[model samples]
Target: MTAALLAGVLAGYGIAIPVGAVGTYLVSLTARTTLRTGVCAALGVATADGLYALAATLGGPALAAALRPVLGPLRWVCVLVLLALAAWGAAGAVRRYRHHRLATHAGAAPVSPARAYLALLGITLLNPTTVIYFAALVLGSQTGDAAGSGERVVFVAAAFAASASWQVLLAGGGALLGRMLTGHRGRLVTALVASGVMTALALRMAVAPV
Candidate 1:
């Protein structure tokens, strides 16, 4: 059980520590919104991670085999989705900046906590790499037969907890960033930089060897 717990924690951090396009967006979104909303969004990401971990634990080799064939296509889909999000974020930020300058007071629509949660969840779910990571870990660890049900539960819970902690820390950093950059130009620059980073990461994903 202890070994399983440790492995799960490692796996969780292994997947979550990489600040990819999703993480970039999460931080930028938090900078634009409230901490409460960011927390919800962060949890949404952890929830998706937990779900993938669970699937890996339960399905093991079969799941990995099934996903292997479609990984290329799924990766393409993820890249496209991320690119679209980057475009949307950049465009929205420009529009908001223009309106702010014009004193029209028209800003981007606020994302409620619930909607933010769902949106982040969907975005994370679309990343097939996450599932592949978990599946590989599960298969490599060979914990399915030896760990038993209780240990598996602990493993899943631990993975979720680890991911949640890391994501929340990211959100906290974003909140601090938002506090530091309260001006219109600062916000616009931050948004554009984040959009550019996300776009670059998405492109990298497209060209990366599968």
Candidate 2:
């Protein structure tokens, strides 16, 4: 249970830390609207992550077994994916900064809290990479019986909590986050730091007991 919780938290933060389009939108929307709406949107994102984590936990063992023979190479593939994710995250941040492509949703009217929640949920659900990332991490897992009913609950709950906490933090930041992301140096520094942390995490995975 402890291992599952730890892994779940790490996995949640692992994916959420990358301030991609959705994250930027969440922060930007909050700065433009109310905290209530932002929090709703944050939860929506967390819900999608929770759902994907649940799917990964439920299907991982069987998938892992089927791929056991090729798990070796797949682990390497996962490593590459992680690296690519890190690089892309950094590069995307830079691009957005350079291109002035912040998700302003310019000229769009403000959405209500409920609408914000549903919109964010649908947007997040459309991201196939989120599920693939979770699935790949689950395949490489050796911590606990992720297939167990109780553990799955714990794992999913932890993942949701982790993601929710971060998303909420971003929403809570409001103008501060918006300013940080919009500022030239601040955005670059933040992106570089996030990428570095993720790279470290990927390297740790590369050396996990195999």
Candidate 3:
């Protein structure tokens, strides 16, 4: 049980710590929207991670083998989605900068909490790395006496809880940062810089060797 708990915690952080496209978007989303929305989005991402972890544990090696063949293509698709998001964020930042008054208007129409959650959930799911990480945990698992159904349940719940806590902390941090940097120039700089970073990361993913 202890090993399974430790494995689940490590697995959660291993997948969450990257702060890749999804993480970038989460920060930006919080900056533009409210903490409530950001929290929902964070939970959405955690939910997806938890689901993938459970799938990996149950499906075992067969599922991993099946996913191996399509990992390359899936990575490309994830890259495309990220690039599109980066483009939209860039455009929004530029527009806000050009029309200072529009910041109020743009921020006024923030996404609802539910919609934000669904959006993040979908985005996280698109990243095949989540499953890959979970699959690795499954492959090397030494749960031993802890491999019972109850232990598996505990593992999944623990992973989800751990992931949700960390993600929520991120969202809170982003919200606090957004408040501190609410100045006109500060907002513009942060938004544009984040967009650029995301675009570069997406391009790197696109060209990366499988």
Lowest lDDT 10-mer window, candidate 3? 101-110
**Please, what is the TM-score per model?**
0.94, 0.61, 0.92
- Ordered by lDDT, highest first, the candidates read 1, 3, 2
Compose the digit string of candidate 1's lDDT tens values, residues 50-75: 99878877887788788888889888
Global lDDT for candidate 3? 0.80
Top candidate when judged by TM-score against the true structure: 1
| Candidate 1, pairs of clashing residues | none
User: Superposing every Cα of model 2 onto the true structure, what RMSD results?
Assistant: 8.0
Each candidate's clash count: 0, 0, 0
- Give the per-residue lDDT digits (tens) of candidate 2, residues 129-151: 46457657767785334357877
Q: Candidates' lDDT values, in order?
A: 0.84, 0.71, 0.80
Off by over 4 Å in 1: 101-108
